[model samples]
Target: MKPFPVATALTIAGSDSGGGAGIQADLRTFSFHRVHGTSAVTAITAQNTRGVTRVDLLPPESVTAQVDAVASDMRVDAVKVGMLAQRPLIEAVADQLARVSLGPIVVDPVMVSRAGSQLIDNEAVEALRSRMLPLAAILTPNRHEAKLLAGMDIQTLEDMREAARRIHALGSRVVLVKGGGMPGALRGTDVWFDGTRMETLSVAPVDTPNTHGTGCTLSAAIAARLALGAPPLEAVRLAKEYVTSALRYPLAVGHGNGPIGHFFPLIHD
Candidate 1:
């Protein structure tokens, strides 16, 4: 028999034609951590550093086919769950997740955009909260997403902690309330809660307009480390550091907002 793979990770996300976010960024992140990556593409997006122009969603059956094909053939050590744009897709993915024994599921709730836009309908959001959140081993949500999940505003660090607490009650084993949208020094401070313990994760904010794939990168990094056998909290901490370091060297790729360099460690200029 041949030697086994180092580790394997699966990304259930959309496709970004820009190659800066979604499955593209996720696969890049897993590669950076020396983990093998597989993917189930839920939607194909026409987008760039500027913004999304169009999106063509795949049928839930097609998404499930990809997921099943991977789960059946490979040993998925961890999973990074991203945008399921509708209630049907959310419920479908949730069902597939229940059937698979894939390791840790790091869920980046892509319910709200950085610009404060609701990406999904109320029913989709409800499906995510009711069906998907409970399946998450780690739920990473930005400020707006945290507010929506917790039903409160997150204006301070304590508010973030409380949001973590409230979202934890929603059934995710752990909740990470990201502070990337927070003001002042609070930015880049993420709160992690696992029902019993609450820990604050603060990294110096890297100011850059090239933050296109940050949310995707962070969650993918966490899943990569988890695939490599890191504990939940440690994985999150390391993922945040990875994202922070990546942001220090943003990729000036497009006309509008650029993207964070996924391979920044190899970038010398």
Candidate 2:
């Protein structure tokens, strides 16, 4: 028999001690999609289901070291970036990504927490917009993040479309503005734009308090699908489907928002 082909993905992000978001969630999502997962942790958060108590960023050199090590050895097929929580970290990540020829980069601009709190400073936001956005193959930002990136409030579907356009103009090949944070009927509806075309993607909203890692999971799934050789748009669609299915069964592990069920298929075995 011929040797099996390998699909590898890299996640450059923070470490979530809660095991619900950041690097933990990204790796889990990659594994579920059958992609080899590697990560470069940029920060470490002392957090749990309830909330984040503290956060410590790694030195810029350390972050770059991890990325260099992975890219030097592995044929990484895709990349997912999350939680570059500081300006220095963002700049470091942007610089290293520029040097390495990793495949499609999926950037999840994680600027705000699920509870509506700003996580990154204004300088960091600007750094990401100017330095990292241009390198992204797909930029996935939730309603709040889109608001910050696009410099406009996103209250309606039309607004999301506008936001996607503005963000895409920043140089990302495509933009996916998640409407999960929107109130009522608009929830779960994601606006997708590829500079020329715009569309909406949605699945039945799964009702659960466990949405801690939803953003990380979705972006990582997109990277995973891309690593598996799907085109950008198809990768986004498959990633959405995967997240929706995973959300169907929430793992009741913590008191606050828990993680999405990233390994449902394996759990049965």
Candidate 3:
């Protein structure tokens, strides 16, 4: 068989040894969307479907070199950025992104893991806000991350909206505040706040314990869509739908929370 043509994407994020989230999830999501995915690993995580045990951040120069090598050679159409562990690393990414001028950047503000591990430190949040958000075409943050960024509790749908607004004001072009953690809701609800408008998207929540990489999957799927020239709203819409289906058919792989079935279509079809 002839090799598939390269439809490239760049993921600047951490590596998950368990292959469920972080760089692993991002690459799988991109490939599922028919794009060739490249990566610049920001950190190495000792984790599984259960949770993250430890994380060692890559040095700033190493991170920068990986990005530069890919950007210089590949026809990268979109970029997805995940966990940057410290201030210098965040700034380094920001600086390299500026140099490369990659657009339709998807920034996932990964704070705590699904297993309740702290991915980003308190000091790094400000750097992410000040240095990275402005470069993103869209910022994807779960409810807790939105609350931390907005410096307020998001207990209601109204508060979610308010949080999105504040996040938009913090230099992101658009904010998609994921409401998975919101109270009184087991449903998959997320709100997208563009500068002048707000939209709510919801799906019937799947009953499963395999949601470890949903956030990373969503952002990478969006980047893949954008690489194929989809608009922002459409990109998000398709990505959400894709994630919903993936979650509906999760891989029960580990002792604790497992991975979503990234190849669900192949299994089902």
Alpha carbon lDDT at 170, candidate 1: 92
Q: Candidate 1: global Cα-lDDT?
A: 0.94
Better model by lDDT, 2 or 3?
A: 2
lDDT for model 3, please: 0.88
Instruction: Report lDDT (CA) for all predictions.
Output: 0.94, 0.91, 0.88
TM-score of each: 0.98, 0.96, 0.95
lDDT of 2: 0.91
Ranking by TM-score: 1, 2, 3
Worst 10 residues of 2 by lDDT: 260-269
**41 Cα displacement, candidate 1 (Å):** 0.1
Instruction: Give the Cα error of residue 10 in candidate 2, in Å.
Output: 0.4
Better of 1 and 3 by lDDT: 1
Those runs of model 3 whose alpha carbons end farther than 4 Å from true positions after fitting are 1-5, 114-118
- Deviation in Å, model 3, residue 57 alpha carbon: 1.4
Instruction: For model 1, give the 10-residue run with minimal summed lDDT.
Output: 260-269
Q: Please tell me which model should have the higher lDDT, number 1 or number 2.
A: 1
